[model samples]
Target: MADKLKVALAIALVVAGVVGFYLLSEQALVLRVLSVLAGVAAAAAVASQSESGRRFVGFARESVTETKKVVWPSRKETVQTTGMVFAFVVVMAIFLWLTDKSLEWVMYDLILGWK
Candidate 1:
C-alpha cells in the first residue's frame, strides 16, 4: 500500500513538473527545462523509496555491471564485418536490378511485342 502511494506521488510530481513547464512558457527556455528536470528528479527520489523502485535500481546496476563485463568486438573485426555487409548489399542490389530488367525485357519485348 505504501509503495503504491509512493508511486502515485512520483507520478503526481512528474505531472506537476509538466504543468509547471507549460505554466512557465513565458519564462526562459532554460528555466522551463529546469522546472521539468526538477520535477523528474523529485519523482525519482520519491519512487526510489518504494520496493519495486529499489528492485529496478538494482536491476539497472546489474545491467551496467554486465555490460562492463562484455567483450566487445575489436575495431578491426568491426570494420571487416561492416565491409562484408556492404559488399553483400552491393552484390544483391546488382543481382536484383538485373533480374528486374530481364523480367521487363521478356514481358514487354518478347512476350507482348510492345517494345
Candidate 2:
C-alpha cells in the first residue's frame, strides 16, 4: 500500500512539474527551469523510496561502475584493425570480380560459340 502511494505521488510530481513549467512560461526562463528541475528531483526522491525504484538505482550504479572498469582499445589499435578489414575486403572484391569475368568468357566464347 505504501509503495503504491509512493509510486502515485512520484507520477503526480512529474506531471505537476510539466504543468508548472508551462504555467510559468511568462516568468523568467531560469526560474521556470529550476522549478521543473526541483519537481523532477522530488519525484525521483519519492520514487527511490519504493522497492523496485531502489533496485533500479542499485542496478544503474553497478552498471556505471562496471563500465568504468572496461579497458577500451587505443586509437592506434582501432585504426590498424580498420585498415586490415578494408584491405581484406578489397582483396576479396578483386578475386570475385576476376572469377566472374573468367566464367563469363568461358561460357560465352568457348562453349556457346555466340558473339
Clashing pairs in 1: none
Q: Each model's C-alpha lDDT?
A: 0.98, 0.94
Q: Which ten residues in a row have the lowest lDDT in candidate 1?
A: 106-115
**Whole-model alpha-carbon lDDT for candidate 1:** 0.98
**TM-score attained by model 2:** 0.70
Scored by lDDT, the top model is 1
Query: What range of 10 consecutive residues in model 2 has the weakest lDDT sum?
Result: 30-39
Off by over 4 Å in 2: 84-115
**Per-residue lDDT tens digits of candidate 2, residues 1-115?**
9999999999999989888899999999888888789889999999999997899899999999999999999999999999999999999999999999999999998999767
- lDDT (Cα, 0-100) at 59 in candidate 1: 98
lDDT of 1 by residue, 62-98 (tens): 9999999999999999999999999999999999999
In angstroms, the error of model 2 at 103 is 12
